[model samples]
Target: MAAVWQQVLAVDARYNAYRTSNFPQFRTQYIRRRSQLLRENAKGGFDPLLRRQYLKLRSQLLAQRYGPLSEQSSFRAYSNSIRSSRTTLDRMEDFDDDLRAQGARGHRRSVSRGSYQLQAQMNRATYEDKSPGSVVPTSVAEASRAMAGDTTLSENYAFAGMCHIFDQHVDKEVPKVQFANDDKNRLACCSLDGTVSIFQLVPTPPAVLRVLRGHSRGVTDFAWSISNDVIVTTSLDATMRIWATEDGKCIREIPDPDCSEVLCCTFQPMNNNLTVVGNSRQNVHVMNISTGKKVKGGSSKLTGHVLSLSFDSPGRILWAGDDRGSIFSFIFDMATGKLTKAKRLVVSEGSSITSISARSWISREARDPSLLVNACVNKLLLYRVVDNEGTLQLKRTFEIQQNSSPVHSIFCPLMSFRQGACVVTGSEDMCVYFFDVERATKAIVNKLQGHSAAVLDVSFNCDESLLASSDARGMVIIWRREQK
Candidate 1:
């Protein structure tokens, strides 16, 4: 027994060496390799000894992977789990009740924050008028047919009326407005007036939280970090600025390397530390926001002035549109932040490509990854993502009054519990349009009126409780979802 114990220690020491050498390979093949090592070492009496050593190694590995089983460590992990769950639930309705129920579930809360986030990513099936919508089906089939049987905007969304109109950028064309990724009640918008306005929606009456001002020219675009702690904005002033969200102070200002107007910007979905920026010089550059430097091999040139940028949910694919009416796809290297141009699709010769949005899945039933595009060709285009290379095949087109303005559109954040999919876009005809992508004859599901100028952009809160649209006249309207 003393000799056997010594052999076990020897085997564990060898395993630890292999683990230190190649941690990832050690993790995946530890069981098989460790067993072989144990058998080879104790060839004469390997049965009971093998079982004992295997169990011991597995236990030690688990303890190392997850923290030690001490009471303080366990309590600390539990508190972190609770905090992560709460942050995720903040985007949902009745989160307080959900948090309390999660607390009661106790021992089942041992999963990591990544697991909780994976479980929380689902389609919104229903909602209350006052609260953001709720409930996703437990299974794909159920989620496909959860709410209304069809996917028409008229069937799914009952917009009560405009909840509020913010004219903070008065007389300046409001180019963009977006809700924070995690907080449903917080949003911000940028205007040609060279300022960005942040707004808070809770506490009854919505009001401006803070106004960010620094650009010498019009603010072209902005993006919120995934953690909601920072915002990055581009401007015609030939520079980009990062702002701390808490105090709305500009932290780092980077001038475009090409000394041209920075036209657009977006944070890498999987990594907030890397940002993709487009400039009027027909160049797109991936930037390291932390050190304020352009990443090596992360820059590419387009045929025309780059106008818009979008990344797939995983940040593995990036799509950029240019004023020459071409959309180009690039493979994003997650580790090095390098970009490899993959394919290009030209919709028209002289028209400008204004916006592009990529979705991994349209609905539970129709699991095809799709891209929504807005080009100045009098149409909104939908393309099916046929391969991992981001090659696009035109699936459908909905007629809109798009001509020249940099109009933008977005997929309804919460997919309706229906068979079809929906997309919302602003039109140059002073209206907001929602189209059922599955409908051929009458693709127009609903048209929102009251914008005094060409509608430039549209966005929806995380839960679909509110929809915000901005226009050329600098008006931003917050529309409420009606309760049935």
Candidate 2:
């Protein structure tokens, strides 16, 4: 009985192994048979013969209990077979004309038989039996010409209506002009035309109401009071003009005895009454805007031409950039009227300072304030200013652009309508680009292009809703963001 049981177990083990091997062979044979049928169907272009065979196979397999086919597998096989058959049909249809032409030529030659007659027949056949779709030079050129013509159609369609015409021409080759927006009531623009224009910002079909003209020569820079009531303009005419924003009348024009051309000017944000003007001779003069009198003992002299100037927080410190790419900070004692020179910040080689501004709401690790300066050679430099016992020092420097056109002017505001701190830069290439300085690497996120000439100035409205850009051709373009 024990021998018999062992024998029975041995036979059962052999049977199981055979079944395992046979199952794989059965699967392999089934796949091979299906593949052959699909290839035949493809070659036949899914004709009635192939379709009938496919439907019969599907029905039979589904009816079998051990078909071992999933719904996904069946669908995949059907889709692949259909795609292959369609492709084969397309190919055959494409070459049908060529096959027909070759067959016709063969029939003509088979009917044509000695030396002279055979030679003549061969020559005639060679002349008449030319290959179809012959490579004619004219046809090839025509095809190439057709392709080239289509390439330009896309660009012409894209820029179909990108042109406009306007009126009025201001012709003074302004380097850059600063714009100020105050309380949505007053709009001030300082131009190299040696004039400051203050217009009322009205709601209905906005337009310039008045033009404030006081300077003798081209006005190089200007700034507006926080209350939007007054405007200060510095010009190449060796004077800084203070004007009333409400009217086009000039309140006072303070003449600079030492420097002839005032390169830049700005009002102290904290002290709305004080204005600082920098000249080509590297000198800064602080004046009482209300009285048109220079602040007593407030003149300070440096080395290079002062290109731009800005005031730090509290109006106690001033940051000035020069044509030599050197930045200096000065401490202003409002009561004592003393100007003490501070540290000079170094910048990139071959770069000259173009514009400067101090952040308002955004503060860094420094105790005093952070300064943002734009250079002529396409870079935005960020410096951390530390106030150590009244002496301002440069703490850090962040380089913005690596290889871009030299920036002609820059404007940095405390807050932007879109998001974080924003800096707008006008370049010599007649374009304006915006930058986000708070983020690392300080990437340029947006650009405005419309100026026919080099962009001379760029500024944002107080609310950051409107952007104004002026070019060398005396064109002023105001752009507003598209509302979402």
Candidate 3:
């Protein structure tokens, strides 16, 4: 019995050492390679033989890395070995007690690091199956349909009329509107009036829940945290403020290190404690919101004033677009939050990029990771993310009037099971446009024409029941999807 206990102890020690030294590096490399292969496979351009070759290569790589540590000596196996080798019932109870204590500590660590949410987000992004039942990209829509009924074919074309119009920031020019992550009813928008209004839509007679006001100048952009507990907003005042959603109080005010107007900001999808902010001085920074300090080696200079920023679903890659019409990609270090610049694509000379949205899976029908971009070139561009290094291949372009306004667009939230996916964009033509992405020509699917001014931004709630669009004239229209 003593010998068996000693062996178990030794195994635990070895596993701990391996986890501390090698597991992290191995996991990073393995995920990187897997993501690259997934991108290649999603393109659907490779023949069966080449696909088999890729699969074989992946198997060999896994074997080479995991061969030394077999399943017999894994963490789970160690626990089972302990259970089997217990000499008496008392010893088994003691082992169970030890496991309970260890589990408590693990739970504490998971909470502190917010790892559970991160893991869930990663799983949704990387779900392999694209079936109607599979919830890779549109879990909310699927869940909504499951609760209510399956969406009908005519429902896809039912976004024509407006349900509500918020004119509180009248004539102030609202630049952005966004629905909270994983939420079906709540949404927020920032305006040139220097305030952010959060709205609740569930109850009848939807109204603004709270107005967040602290910025000295026009609020440029804002991002909601993963848990929707707080919001971070950038402003023309050259400061970024974190606001508590519970009471709409300013928790922390962080000034830009360069003392330039902060143009845009986004929460690092995997880490709410970290936010990526773009400034008018041509700098992109990764900020530790908890400490209100910039992460070391996480700052990079762009070719022009950084106008838009986006991250792939996993948060491994960041794409930032500048006023010079160039989009630059950077590799984001998940552990340290460091950024390494990777690739760049020039859309057009002197055309400002107004928005960048990255979607890993546009729909179950279209599995390619795509970037939806709005620039000053009078067109909305769609590009396929081709490689792990953040290279982009232009796939399609939809014409729109986007000559001057800082217009934005988004992938429809409930498009996963639709026969064809759709993208919605705010246009300078004073309209909201939806384009069927799979259509080869005449791709316009639906148009909402209530906004009298150039539409600046668009957002959809998690279930796609409500879409909120903001225009340049400070009008926010909430469009309801007609149920058939």
Choose the strongest candidate by TM-score: 1
Query: In model 3, where do residues sit more than 4 Å from their true spots?
Result: 1-154, 360-365
Q: Among all windows of ten consecutive residues in candidate 3, which has the lowest summed lDDT? A: 83-92
Better of 1 and 3 by TM-score: 1
lDDT of 2 by residue, 1-484 (tens): 2112222222222222223464644432333334334434444444555455555565455446234434323332332232223222222222233335567788332321122333343234211212221211122132223222322211211211212221133665545444453243345555665655554445645567677766668777777665456677778888888777666688887887575788788776556677888888888888777677778778888668888887764566787878776777788886754567876776755467777766543211111245666776445565544443222334333344424332443434422212234556666667677655444563555666777776666665544446666767667666664432
Question: Where does model 1 exceed 4 Å of error?
Answer: 1-140, 147-153, 360-362
- What is the C-alpha lDDT profile of model 1 across 17-72, one tens digit per residue? 23545454342234334433543455456567665777588657856864455532
Q: What's the CA error at residue 15 for candidate 1, in Å? A: 26
Question: Where's the lowest-lDDT run of ten residues in candidate 2?
Answer: 153-162
Among residues 3 or more apart in sequence or in different chains, the pairs in candidate 1 whose N, CA or C atoms overlap within 3 Å are: none
Question: Ranking under lDDT, best-scoring first?
Answer: 3, 1, 2
In order, the Cα lDDT scores of the candidates are 0.74, 0.53, 0.75
TM-score of 3: 0.71
lDDT of each residue in 1-484, candidate 3, tens digit only: 2222323333332333334364554432333233333433444555655555654564455446544455323433333323222211122222233335667788433432433333343344332333432223233234223323455324665775888899999999999999987577899999999999999887968899999999999999999876678899999999999999989999999999999999999888767789999999999999998899999999999999999999986688999999999999999998999999999999998999999999732343233578899999999999887778789888889999999899999987544344456789999999999887767888888888999999999998866778999999999999988866
Q: What TM-score does each of the candidates earn?
A: 0.73, 0.58, 0.71
Better of 2 and 3 by TM-score: 3
Candidate 1 local Cα displacement, residue 386, angstroms: 1.2
Q: Which prediction has more favorable lDDT, 1 or 2?
A: 1
